[model samples]
Target: MKKILVVDDEFDILTTWRLILEMEGYEVTTASNGRVALESARANPPDLVITDWMMPHMDGVAFIRELAANDSLAQVPVILMSAAAHAPTLEHGNAQFRRKPLSIDDLLDLVKHKLGEA
Candidate 1:
């Protein structure tokens, strides 16, 4: 089973994404803040990561940089979602990005595509 780690500050967003991704038969884990996200990722790296840009401790960019830097976690694909449309330009390599308020279908499509199952 493919694992997905979702990092978002909003509780509702985390729950909603968990439900949606779970229903699609993907194993899902969530972190409410960037600090927790880093710990979780280091503990059990996911096959894919979907992270929000603005978080209290680590922020998405730093998290991605860390992930990319680590040899064990660097192969995992990332899908960055943010309200800011400028986020995609900030990072490069093996990532899919989307704006917020995307439908479940679009989210799943991106996930599937990133995982090379689409």
Candidate 2:
């Protein structure tokens, strides 16, 4: 099974994602913010990460950079989601962008694509 770390400050969003991903057979781990997510990832690197852009205590961009800094985690792909009017720059080649209100089917497909299981 593929492991996915989901980072979001909102508990409801986190829970929803966990349930959805779990039902699809992905081993889901969730963090409330980038800081916690980074720590967790370092301890046990996941296959992929799904994160919200505007989290507190280290945002998505900063988290991606941190992961990139580590040789072991740099290559891990990420899907960054945001509700902002203007999209944030996604410079990480291994990272992808998704706007808020993304459909569940789209999210699942993206996850599969990222994991090379599509």
Best by TM-score: 2
Q: Mind giving the per-residue lDDT tens digits that candidate 1 earns over 1-118? A: 8889999998889899999988888889999767788789999989999988888788887788788777888888988888885754544367766788888889988888877551
TM-scores for every predicted model: 0.90, 0.94
- The C-alpha stretches of model 1 lying farther than 4 A from their native spots are 88-92, 116-118
TM-score computed on alpha carbons, candidate 2: 0.94
Candidate 2: pairs in clash? none
107: Cα error in model 2, Å: 0.4
Worst-scoring 10-residue span by lDDT in model 1: 85-94
Summed backbone clashes in each candidate are 0, 0
**Model 1 clashing residue pairs (backbone):** none
